[model samples]
Target: MQSFRDEIENPIVQKEIIDLEKKIYSFRNGQIDDERFRSLRLARGIYGQRQEGVQMIRIKLPYGKVSSEQLKRITEVSDKYSTGRLHITTRQDIQIHYVSLDRTPELWADLAKDDITLREACGNTVRNITGSELAGVDVDEPFDITPYAHGLFQYLLRNPICQEMGRKFKISFSSSEKDSALSYLHDLGFIPKIVNGEKGFKIMLGGGLGSQPSHAELLSEFVPVNQIIPTAEGVIRVFDRHGERAKRLKARLKFLIKDLGRDEFLRLVDEEKKALPFHSYEIETAAFEGPITEPLLAVPSVTIDDVEAFEAWKKSNVIAQKQAGYVAIGIKVSLGDFYTDKARVLADLIKNYGANELRFSLRQNIVIRNIKEENLAFFYQELAKLDFVTLGYNTIGDVTACPGTDTCNLGIASSTGIATELERVLATEYPQYADNTGISIKISGCMNACGQHNMSEIGFQGMSINSGKLVAPALQVLLGGGILGDGKGRFSDKVIKIPSRRGPDALRYILNDFEANANGQSFLNYYDAKGEKYFYDFLLPLSDVTNLTEEDFVDWGNADNYVKAVGVGECAGVVIDLVATLLFEAKDKLTFSHEALQEGKWSDSIYLTYAGFVNGAKALLLAEGQKTNTHAGIIDLFDTVFVETNKIELSSSFKDLVYQINKKEPSEAFAKAYIQEGVAFFENIENYRAKDLANA
Candidate 1:
């Protein structure tokens, strides 16, 4: 760790890596609480896997953009610290599994050399900012949204307001009205629009996909690009202060929007305006506005053995770019899994033959941009050598799935196994759908929707079905979910549940029925016309358990009989309620407050000081076995249990003391005074607690 620290040149990042190393050491020595350590490691992007004593590190990539150099750097780090296999997530980040927790700081330091990061990639913070891979080159886009997406990600990566929220927050940017980024299913979604020749965006708020999927409400029809950051910050502040903390299931921003109507929720966001650090953040767009300047180099010559197959590949996998004479090629990664050796080869191919950059698509596929149109045959032959020139790019044959029971703690069934079999079924039985991009299939190990199963045209969620004394892996079939463009969409309805081995037959039945009766309608339109019960009646026969064979008891990709074992999920970091740990965290908050104050970030310092007060008061409340849920609840309860009861003396009511954050403007004078007050409050609480503990 010390050697890596010396190699890292950025002082701020070096300090962060060193701090993580220290925290890991303390946690290993049992000096930190289990829940506290879980939260800490998750914030740094080290996640616990289904198997013990190993981790899954999520490498956050803004808008899923990666250059050739960065790709090589990632491959190198994966080879050193983890398995050589990389898994692309739905949000366009790369995940490497089976990593040792002790080496995370070193791994992070190495990636930092290539300008990559793992900070705030997981836990209750704002996750990786996602957008369309076609942002700059899509034919239908009004303007490029790359710089704006990049701008927002930079502003919020380590913002104090979003570091510790009630639940994870997701944000997305779409290139155009096509909404390729799935704007309707994020906490905040932005769709680029040019109104009166001015650059602006239509914002969607409070949308999420889980067991209960919710469509985002339109927060604004148009806000200038300069105001997007401030608008997002305001919404995050409201969520941090008011979102549920005690109930894990009810902690997302969507639930908060449901509890408080959209009107009231927006009103709270408006109330946070005074405390915001900026009224509008102007995104620097000039860097993204440019034309291709590649020299006209000599094209390489190659021969294609299978002309028919090559033509089919060109028809399906090749995409037209907004830039003339250039095209983007899509690589349909099977189950979003790719090994390091092929990745290195692919990176070199793109660097030499095409643009040095690649963007991971939202569907867990790779899009290589800036390939000259004239060199199609040569590039095809090269890609065919890597076995990457598959016929389908983003069609029904390209399935999106999560690593269900394979590595996820919450997985009850094998999502990847069933997904693979289904993909094979589509390839062998329904070849016509290979280029049919209208329909989509997605699967998740469980109801958490990590695979985004709830928001696809056809979806499957992992589950288990019990018959007498035996249990088998099961899948809940769903229908009628798709993007409706411009921040509107529908969530799939649960249609039926069938054994995992029967998944391929279920897909065959659905597709066969659609082909016979749909009569040229889109999949979503046909599902709407037929209604839920119409398909349920036809597919219900597969749900029968009495006719089960012995093979039905064994799940997909497994040789033994199925056994259901679900572990605690850490997607939303665990709540830490230990009294001593809470008090210690309060002191840590003050240290952070002083750092922010010294850096001249007034709003950040104020919020950190405010959090310190709440944490200190909550520590005393928890010492008495009181329930502390929301920040507002903690303030009121602290006043009730401590101030009003005179158990702990204070200059004023706790609510009056802490509520000053919202009531007063975030000026440097106010921030300094707030830090001082927090210092005094901590000293009082620590002394009182020490006396109380001594007496007990």
Candidate 2:
């Protein structure tokens, strides 16, 4: 542990790891509150698991890019800190489970030695920034978006504005108009666009998936590359100032846009331009512009033992790169689970044979880029040694799943179990679909959509069915959802609920009908043509609970009877609304505002002051037993409960005082004055609390 501490070079990162260690010690000693400690650990990517004493650590990899050295480092860290198993998430992050809570600081320091991080990977902060796996090598892309994605990830990693918000924020970049990165389902999504030969992006905003899925609204058709980061600053400022705070489920940016029309949301975004740190922050793409590697002197000639298998692998897993004479290979990682042994082997294979870089796909697979076209056979043979060469890479056989009951606290069923069973059914019986890239099947243990199940062509959500004096594991069948490209898509329709044991049978029925009657149309088009009710009727028999046998009481991959037990989810850190805690937080934010002001970060200072106002107001509102849900609601309610009533007098309304953040430019004078206002507001609240307590 001391060796790891000595390896850290960045003073800020070193301080972060030290603070985490101290916090863990305080929490173990009962010096820190449980809810407060949960927030701290989650923001650092240390999450409590379903099991009592273990944690799940999510390793954030920007745009899913990993170097051979970094991959080897991750394997080493995983082997030392936790189990050797690595789980790839739908967001292109790698999660390792069953870790001791106390060793996280050392684990984080070890990761930092290779320039990998765990910050903001979980909790109610900006999660990992993702991009197209083929970003730098896609033939259809107007330009590489890798540098832009990387820049955003760097700029916001430990930024002051998003350290703690109401809920998690997600951002993505699609390499092309295909929207392979699923742009339509993120808080902010970017698709490359070229206007008059100038590179830009088409922005999508406020889209999300949970129990309720909403499509994103088109924010901008085209924004110049230099202006994108500043635009993002404005958008985040607005979200931070007005997003929800108390109601966890309703706290996402989508609900705010739904409450206020898109026009008003964009108007607010425009209003924050004056508060942005940079009017146009340009990203340097020179380093990512050219080819990363060249072919070796000679192509190795080899005889293939099974030419048919080789051809199938090529058709399904191999992709031609934009760089001629090079190709990218896809390795289908089943259920997003891989061991460190295979990881090390793949790391060596990529370093020795292919390009030294790899990108993890949103579907939980790995894409090795920059392999010479002539070396495809050689690379395939090398990957085969590690059992890493899996065909049907992103096809129907390649199912996407989350760590359902295996690790996640909110898991309701066995997503990994069902996903494995479905893949087996597809490979053994429906072999013809081995190359069918049109359909996608995804599963989530619950409706959280961690697996992006609600947006797949065919989807399943974990649920339970109630029978007389008994409960059985069930899946909510969904249909007709898929990406439509260019920031447009549809959510799946919940067709019916069926027993989990009949999951394979349900798939068979759907595929059998589609193959017989689809008439060569894609699954989405056929689903649209046939309608939800038609399929619902066809699969209605599976929904019958009266015919359930003893096996139906057990879930997939489980030997015991099914029990519906869901733990508290830490995906969004627990909300602590204690009046004292809120007041302390307000004062802490005021301190941060002063520090940012000294650093000449006027935008950061302004946002910090705004957060202070919100926290101070929410503290008083909670003292008065007022419901503090949204930031906007807090401001308005404070004006009603205190300002209007003369309990706390001010020159203007509370809304007017707080909303000045958008009206005034982020200058030194404005930041200093705003800090004064926040200080005055907090003092007034403190005095009122003291008087109220004394009078009582």
Summarize candidate 1's per-residue lDDT along 351-436 as a digit string, tens digits.
77676789999989999888888889998988888889988899999999999999999999999999999999999999878788
Residue 40 displacement in candidate 2 (angstroms): 1.9
**Candidate 1: clashing pairs of residues:** none
Candidate 1, position 450, lDDT? 93
Instruction: Give all candidates' CA lDDT scores.
Output: 0.91, 0.90
**Residue range 1-696, candidate 2, lDDT tens digits:** 456778899877898899899999989998778898899999999999999999999999999999889999999989998889999999999999999999999999999988999999999899999999999899999989999999888889888778888899999999999999888999999999999999999999999999999999999999999988888877777787678877889989999889888999889888877767788898987877765765333446777798898988898899999988888999999998999999998887777766689999999999999988778888878788888788889899999999998888999988998999999999999988888888999999998999888998899999888988799989999999999999999999999999999999999999999999999898999998999999999999999998999999999989999998899999888788788778888898999899889989887898888889988898889988999877778999999999999999998999999988877877899999999998998888889989988998
Total clashes for model 2:
0
Question: Cα miss at 522, model 1 (Å)?
Answer: 1.2
